[model samples]
Target: MKIRSFFTAILTALFGIFYLPSANAHALYVFAQYDGQVLSGKSYYSDMAPAAATYFEVFRSGIEEPILTGKTDVLGAFNIAVPDAPNTTLKVVVEGEEGHKVSVVADRTMVSNSSNDNFMLLREDIAHLKDKIYLHDILGGIGYIVGIAGLIAWLNSRKIKQGAK
Candidate 1:
């Protein structure tokens, strides 16, 4: 019985060790828009937490050189005045200190909105939407949970049967 309890504790600890990293892990995402002249936006993690003080780089599409570099404010907000170039493609990259990086591409249509209010409305629209959720992925996770529970139950039943024998 003591050996079983010890093994159970070890198994639980091992499971925790393997699960904690992914469970706590966050994927970074940056969303930016240019309202005709000023490019501005925010960076956030998977949990919708602000990615504050992160460095951001702006690049022209198909150009290897960064056009501008800036850092987010305390609220994860950033703004930079851009040229009045219409139909330009811009790429924005936000880098986190923990080696996490997220990039977003903005085309003319994205930033050509006349006012900041329009840009902000677009941001709010995106913010309200949920991230992509695949049906198969969810089903697979459910299957894994059910399988693990069944295996544990089977092992317990086997122990009971053996003890009765």
Candidate 2:
């Protein structure tokens, strides 16, 4: 019986390893920003591979027709100057191979009035803020674990007192 049970557990583990959907892939994403006059961003695959020479289409807000079309450079970067765009937002669509297309939108809100050289510094600041928030979330999760453990201890103590009575 013991050997049979061990064999059964091994088979279950093997089946779980083979049949379960455990493989995870990072999702493809794009981020674009406007620098008062130009829109620019990089295109990348889920695996952090550069999407070189990818064709992109730009559409204005609520416009069915694309206003501009272009291709990325070897570095997977594209920049377009829209000095007189009437709309406040621009959408960039990258048509990737294997039907892995992605779209990103650039808005006027990202266009700071500061000097052009400050953009990289500003991006770093935003990244730091994200890190702080992530840290805060991790601390909150620890607090929740402690709270649940305390509750369980209190419940067990109450049960012990009833047994003593």
Residue 53 displacement in candidate 1 (angstroms): 0.6
Best by TM-score: 1
How much lDDT does candidate 1 score? 0.75
- In model 1, the Cα lDDT at residue 52 comes to 90
Candidate 2 per-residue lDDT, tens place, 1-165, comes to 954885687577546545762542334455567766787776766545667888988888878998889998986777888665664678888887667688878745455566754674465345334433243664576578658867987999899999999
Writing each residue's lDDT as its tens digit, candidate 1 over 141-165 gives 7678668877998999999999999
Clash tally, candidates in order: 0, 0
Q: What range of 10 consecutive residues in model 1 has the weakest lDDT sum?
A: 106-115
List per-prediction Cα lDDT, in the order shown: 0.75, 0.69
